[model samples]
Target: MIKLIGVALIAAGFALRVNTLLVVLAAGLATGFAAGFSLNEIMAMIGKYFTDNRAMTLPIVLMLPVVGLLERYGLKERAEVLIRRSKAATAGRVILLYTAVRQISISLGVSIGGHAGAVRPLVAPMAEAAARGRGGELSAASVVSIRAHAAAGENIGNFFGEDIFIAVGAILLMKGFFEAQGMNVSVWAMALWGIPTAFIAFAAMWWRCQMLDRRIERTAADNAKAGGVQ
Candidate 1:
């Protein structure tokens, strides 16, 4: 039971708003001590786990520099310019389109699109530009709202779409969990069930996107009125 002190530490640390890395490290150390592990043993265990999972962090390490260079070279500006060329583009439509593309691509097991690689540098900027095209200056609140919706599209698309791929980790995890409970659940069945779930998720997000468009329009109208009053 003392080994569970780590869980309590994590909850307390997060509730207190401590630095995440420090909180995790402190929890790990406390847990290791409670479990009767030597400091050296705990350090070795941490090193081994990090080495085993290094592949997960490699993408972030490689992607950040490239993304930074692109942004420095006007990636967001280019995306904005491209989106503005389409007269029919609205902030919601831009997000909805990306959501579709993200869902379809991930369902096929193509691990494309992420908040860091796609949303920040491309989708959010494009959506903001589309909002500006609606014929009024956007308030800071409106810009933040558009960016939040862009992030929501990426998150919803990724979370629901990955389960549709039979080889994805989530499907295999579900299969293993059910088998452990003495229930026979096939990966294919899980993937098949995910189809309806993905469709429902897409439909829900589409409705939210429509609401986002109306919100953008209302913000624009309010800003226009405020300008007239000035």
Candidate 2:
């Protein structure tokens, strides 16, 4: 029963909305102490874990500084400028392209496609700029719609594309499950099949974005007419 103190700590920390990193570390330490480990042993275990995974986390650590530097120096403005000049590019189209880029990048193990790191600072603002250029002006609702579409694109693309990588955890789990059931499955087969599925999903999402663009344009036109009539 006392062994569950670690889990309890996690629940309490989360419920209290404490700093997540501190909470998790505290929970682990508490759990280790409760489970009969000395403080030194617990500290050693934590160090060992980080050591074992050092290479894996190094890239993430490197990316944080790089992303921060970009934001500090106006990467968002650069992204907006790049998107605004393309006459045929709408908010939805710009984001859709970002979705594709993010998916491909994520499949290769780079995860710069997140909401805070990529979407908000780069993708969303560029999308807003693109839309405002097309329609001459943008309402708050239009801005929200553009950002929402960018977020949705990042989410959907990342969700479906990552599983296609043979070395990804999900495909490995699938391989293990099939083998346990006395059926043979190959990782290569999963990767091969995932390509077409990803393409289909991307096309479907692209079509939906196009529809949203049309709807936003119509709403803008309707609002204009109503204002003129008043």
Best by TM-score: 1
- lDDT (0 to 1) per candidate: 0.83, 0.78
Clash list (residue pairs), candidate 2:
none
Provide TM-scores for the models: 0.68, 0.63
**Local accuracy of candidate 2 as per-residue lDDT tens digits, 1-230:** 98888899899999999999999999999889989999999999999866754545556576788878876898756755765566646877888888887788777765655798778877887777777676657766777778888889999789778877776656766776686589999888987788888888799889978976887787678767777312
Off by over 4 Å in 2: 1-4, 34-36, 61-88, 109-122, 133-136, 155-208, 228-230
Model 1 backbone overlap count: 0
